[model samples]
Target: MKTNFLFTMLTGLLLFTACSEKPATTYTINGTIPDNSLDGKMIYIYNRDNNNLNIDSTVVTGTTFTFTGKMDTAAYCRIDASREYYVNFILENGTINLDLSKPVSPSGSPLNDEIARFFAAQDSMSDLIDSKRQEFMKQTEDKEERMKLQKDFFQNEWKPAYLAMLDGFFDRNLNNPIGGMALNYMDGYLSTDQIKAKLSLLSEPVRNTPSMQERLQRFDALEKTAEGKPFTDFTIETEDGNKVSLSDYVGKGKYTLVDFWASWCGPCRAETPVLAEVYNQYKNKGLEVLGVAVWDSPENTKKAIEELKITWPQILNAGEKPTKLYGINGIPHIILFGPDGTIIARDLRGDGLKAKVKEVIETK
Candidate 1:
């Protein structure tokens, strides 16, 4: 009886252990290059879904490098080298060896060719922008014309090429590994308006995907913030603990210049004298200026305020919370609020700020 009981206990323990254990899943990649210089170079492996887990280059030894990591299943993987070489591979639970000497394409699909073409086009567009910039600087004496040319290069040449690349990738394979990575890259650079324009070009099926849906939502939120329609009732505390709000300043029907800046920002510092002059001139004529300083320590900000002789109510030490609330990412950001607490203009600087302020107050 005792022997039987011991046997039963051992069997149960073994069964539990077997049920709980998970199989080790790893991918091993090895490569050899003809050039001895390729040895000791770094190779990077990127996971498509979790971008934060994107691993850096694995050191190459004798023109060979091996990467070991547990993947959930056979998913998309990108192998990058010195010349920006990319290949998509299905990483199974076993060891997979890759030889650079042998031609091994990503996923053995024609879409890789399409991606390569798109990258070539991207390079071409970058070259075009550089060339246009040089020409604009040489031929144009007007600063406005040069700025317009720069904007057009990005809006027309650069942006259209990027959109074309995305459309081409999706057309080839909706679930392409490279396509997903390209989409993430686009999200980083493109503005809200540019993204919306690109999304309008995508097919219905691609638009309906969960990833695309989330991106669209982000674009919408950003667009709304950029419009500055929601920054009403702007308020902050002064360094002396005095509670100041836009409502109190603009209460008696006065135009307010809600300036967003910081002491550490060089551009903001440069613009301070101009702002002070404008404020001094317009303060008696129903103009109120409020400087909202972000991302600065209180002591440093106080010193700057004294040095710049800023007499207006300055809000210091709001950190990033208020800045994000107002959707302000850049320093030297200025917003013109009408008497009714509605945002009339945004990011006005130097002559632009002066022009807008004069136009609004004079018209009123």
Candidate 2:
């Protein structure tokens, strides 16, 4: 009996030792590349959440490379062998296997597996849509009719399905990096209120991340500049080294068309002629057009103005100041301000721009 008791005690001690020696929570990436030329090359993993800084690196030994790190929380990162070859994945506590040979494949981790499933679903839907588009193109000979049908299919059918899938993804990852990533992608698809609802569902720690905080601030700015809200004033220095306030042009007893654009933006350039036409038609009849060059260098702005024949008074070198104030995410964002500086309409472009200006100026 004593011998049996001694054996049981020994077994318990062994079990305790085994449990105590277990490794702590950490992540490891086991990666492989098939190209023989890159056997001795360097592999880098960048933390995209933190200014895309290199968080870890390794030398490719033979055709394989490995990286291991302890993460307090999950982060979005990318593994790059070169600019041409990179795969973005969530770095979490688990072993992740990546094959960067023919196509990038990330597996063997929970979040990575989820990402694979998400992408597969997206691709399948995209393929289905493309097939429908091709079939419709064959049947519909009229160019305008084909384009209209395609637009309806994409908007009414495919987009809702895509958004629903994304909603499921976000719902599954409300407290993780994946949720934050999902929110970032939903900006163009979802309305501001919808995004706000999704963001509110996240935990405090996830919502307070730098990227998420920036999204929150942008939403606030959007609210401040919604249609009918008074225009927010800001100042920027022009290419001529003169300081100018948006107030200098806006709220000066005339309807002002404020264009927040960049020199490198194609759509902005295309819309310039439309703006010039409107200005010429109505400048003598209570209209003023102001060009605020944003997200471009002074040299490029001046060159674009000369090439595009933009004779309107321009505020150059504005950078991100005006965009942030107005929550303008894309270039060619044009706002029509009332004579007293109240925002009349926004997001004007093409014929719609001309129509809005004409309606207001002619009636005045």
RMSD, every candidate, angstroms: 16.7, 11.7
Model 1 regions lying over 4 Å from their true place: 1-67, 71-124, 136-230, 233-252, 306-309
Listed in order, each prediction's TM-score against the native is 0.57, 0.87
Residue lDDT tens for model 2, 199-233: 99998878877778878898999999999999999
lDDT of each: 0.63, 0.81
lDDT of 1 at 137: 97
Candidate maximizing lDDT: 2
Candidate 2 ranges beyond 4 A from true positions = 1-24, 36-43, 101-104
* Model 1 agreement with the true structure over 250-357: per-residue lDDT tens digits: 435778887778888999999888788889888888899988788988898889999888899877776765565565657888888777666778788999999988
| Residue-level error in angstroms, candidate 2, position 177 | 2.0
* Cα error of candidate 2 at position 236, Å: 1.2
Which candidate gets the maximum TM-score versus the true structure? 2
